[model samples]
Target: MDALPTDPEPTDTRPTDAAPTDAVLDRAAGAVIGSAAGDALGAGYEFGPPLPDDARVGMVGGGTFAWAPGEWTDDTSMAVAVLRALAAGEPLDDDRTLDGVVDAWCGWAVDAKDVGNQTRAVLGGLAPRTAAAARRSARAFHDTYRRSGGNGSLMRTGPVALAYLGDGREGDLARAARAVSDLTHAEDDAGDACVLWSLAVRHAIRTGVADVRVGLPWLPATRRDPWAARIADAEVSRPRDFDRNGWVVEALQAAWSAITHGTTLVDVLERAVRGGRDTDTVAAIAGALVGARDGASAVPAAWRDVLHGWPGLDAAALTDLAARAVRR
Candidate 1:
């Protein structure tokens, strides 16, 4: 396993002056709205073969999970839990915040139609349902079985970026992303993937351009070169080449490959979904960077009009929740 930073965000401030601008807020909200939208769009096609070039994709749900049309899956549902946890206004890595995230995830998992295998093992198997219990279980699972690098963590990592959108919070963003990912996916690679993807989303939100490499500095020195090579490969490849998109690394590559291949948010998400395998998750992952790059306006109104998921959130409510959470 690769070594990655696992520190918590040491410094924080509720600076009103450093609050997100309208544009930044729009991009932040876009990350959430677009993530759910893409999840719903891809829900119908999960685990299928690569789609034909001319195949039409939309939020027409119903797969192995039988999701409702325009309804998100565990990807966005877990993300909604993270967003709610962040809205508590504590540091992202705080025990209180992580515990609240665990609590929310447990609540949602109780009735969620679909939950990731790794996530359910850790969450449902815990005795007390505390963050501490969940982490210990997840860590032991990885240490014993050595196969916890699923895409589950990365799919929900986009909302962690919103917690540190204030100026000079890049380090906080990286640390928080890893810390949250560790709650369910303690494998080093899973944490590393979340750090890179979260920082990329934050960068796109700040700059309105999608560049996944912007977070290399936050990774451990030993793994930086390898991740760079992976990113380079993604730039020259198509999403369909990543056949094992359920793994964290391939999921990132597939999502980044999708991101690099398209000119717009919708196009990128479509490319991600059509790549097949873990279609909803790959598209949900791409949606974060693309949405942060393109802003909420880039998401088509028709998609947002129908997007719905866990906790009874619609696209508009999702935007509002993300806005409120980031402001915390």
Candidate 2:
């Protein structure tokens, strides 16, 4: 692990008169809306299906199997549940939030919808424990199956980051991220990667375009992880050498680079998506960061309309939660 960054001077450039309530609401609204839109947009291409040339084509269309328009899979559904729990005043540091996360997962499973394999296994294994047993057993269960460094844990973490920004609590944000991720992915790398990404997104939203170098000061000091070194290098490098693996470190680097390299939210997301591999997750991650910086107003209107009516989960309700949770 590389050394984590020292706290940099605050770079918030919103109007001095900007109300706290307004800023929070904007950040929250942008987060949920961006997430749903990214999920819906990428749903067409999930599992590696090609995106339609028209782009506006709702269903996958003839000759190709058509998916129902605006349907989000488990990604957005679980995220909505998480957001609802947070909005109900669950604290990230407390056991209650963990229970809320578990409850949310159970609610989603009741619908018999698609779920990630690792997430399903974790949730299924811990369902029978009483609250105390559930907590202890779940932690042990998470520790047992620790190899899931997949983007699933990272995808739904935006709300936690937004909710905890500027609380001045040491490791609170990172801990919150870990609590959410540890529900399914307790691996150190997965949890740490989620924390790093959440912090980057929060920094972007608060400061418009935070220097990625800021993150270098926060890297752990044990092993000289090449991933941390690579990100640190990208923070100071030229445009051509950035890597875009589907790996979490690569995805974080790509998201930061896209923000620094592009002038608009769509440009950043497009850059992230076109990098391929785990394109959807990368795009979703970038979208959260960009959306925080630019707010929901920066997203395209047509995309918002398409996202609003996505099937199963209520995209609008999630957006509403985002709006309500962060309202100053």
Candidate 3:
């Protein structure tokens, strides 16, 4: 592992704000590709504390897990699984869609070089494709792991937001986000972060601006106030200020801290990655939202050119899924 910085400077937030309209395909492609790029960029530095200003910090890959350069981990792979199911026109709330996603998740989890503990427990014991089976497995995992507030579900939820674009009500989107998240993480905070983050993604994709506040109305009263407070906190904090160790709440705070503070998509992702702990996931989560806000064009060409991940997907393949997902 490379030596990392013990103290990083606060992110500079002075870029001009621009909300450019883009084709749905470009926005969708941006969401997926941007996420994969962030994951790949941060993969090489996972858990290696922060980096000094002079240190090299692009997508060099090969870290604690030694991934190939430009290879994404489970974060993007799981989102692709959801996108594959949605591209087939399966309804979000239907058992068929959920079953297909669960099956895909099972396959990915079995072969994934990096799966979260909560996700591993839930999908590790999955049986046939039924709602009952999915619920039972998830519940069992929750029982075994009492404090299951991992960020596993949030990292994979970007596509779910895009899939519902222009088609469903905010409530529908929230339900879908919550349902999918509950499959592996049964905690309220986990589901809350998914709904909040997905809503932010959806808003960015539709309007080309990264304002998480747009999703506030969809949250129930119980969660709305708390999340609003958290979002406010993010606007003023540094990425390192939040715990980046995979806890869902802290993960959201970390990602949002980067998102709200950075002026461009690259700025957000780089800040998230440089913050160090859980680098890939934090950057991946920020990538989805910032990518949607700025479109695929915002992602650097160098990173996008080599982005690839599990299930043998390159940028083109992921972008194809994004296009198909939106067309459906």
Candidate 4:
């Protein structure tokens, strides 16, 4: 294979340094664009194993959703919803902030392709209600699907890091992450996974290294021991060791496993999608972490140039949203 290029792609008007360090903007844009690139790359082969070495892995679309080549799936769409909510100029943990997110989610879900079962159930049922009422409805919905633990929440969590990080407040970041997850997913694991991944993205964007273990201490005592052990084990494991079937625990494990084992953005994304089932979400999750670590410039120009998604966002638009998100 050819070596991955290092030039930054044409996405978003690069954020000015007056707001933050150039590294911050680069990683912020990378987090959003990287997720979309990974989603589009993996979309063509959703629910399937890695292609043969000779087969092209570039975005060709036509998976279960039959998307156009270069188009991202619901993962990027939902994340953008969260980003839009944060861009509304309210505190991340405010009731109005959560309401904005809930509204954006329901609006997106109205015709969203490939919506997750858990998310669809909560949003479809509670979208018309007030945020307080929706939270209650989401809890009841959670009771019915507590054991399933889908990766729906985790897939869109990258934006939370951008919104809440750099404030010198990990607590606010955790609260925002949990709040975002609880909107549609009631399970503790689902919420925990979002916090863990969002914090990892925060650490990577702020520090230029993707370390899944950084957020382990923030987990509740009940989950800390098990999640810590699993993350430690995943760091040395191969991608196939994880069950990439959309469960949040396994999804987190799969993403962290690939990230720890791979040496570069290309290496991480390739290993992520090769696990087969839930390819796009797994790769998108991993992409957010590694992209935050490496910056948007690390994504290949071929993929970046064509990256697009629902709600009419291409790489540039998503980066613009991401830039605005980090500033808020």
Best by TM-score: 1
What's the count of clashing pairs in each model shown? Answer: 0, 8, 1, 0
lDDT of 1 by residue, 143-260 (tens): 8887899999999988889877766687888888988898999987898899899988887887787888878878888888999999999999998999999999999999999999
Better of 1 and 4 by lDDT: 1
**Better model by lDDT: candidate 2 vs candidate 3:** 3
Model 1 segments beyond 4 Å from truth? Answer: 1-17
In model 1, the Cα lDDT at residue 89 comes to 68
On the 0 to 100 scale, the lDDT of residue 263 in model 3 is 84
Q: What C-alpha lDDT, on a 0 to 100 scale, does residue 56 get in candidate 2?
A: 38
**Best to worst by lDDT, what's the order?**
1, 3, 4, 2
- Residues 1-328 of candidate 4 have per-residue lDDT tens digits of 1121222221123333247688888998888887888888788788886554334565788988898888888899888877777666667677777777777778878887788887777778574545676677778887765553789889999888887565455667777888878777777888888878888888888778787766766677667788898788787776666765588988889888888878888888888877778889988998999899999999998888888876887787877888887787
In candidate 2, the residue pairs with backbone N, CA or C atoms under 3 Å apart (3 or more residues apart, or in different chains) clash, namely 1-223, 3-219, 4-217, 4-218, 4-219, 5-217, 5-218, 21-328
Q: lDDT of all predictions, in order shown?
A: 0.86, 0.59, 0.79, 0.78
Candidate 1 local accuracy as lDDT?
0.86
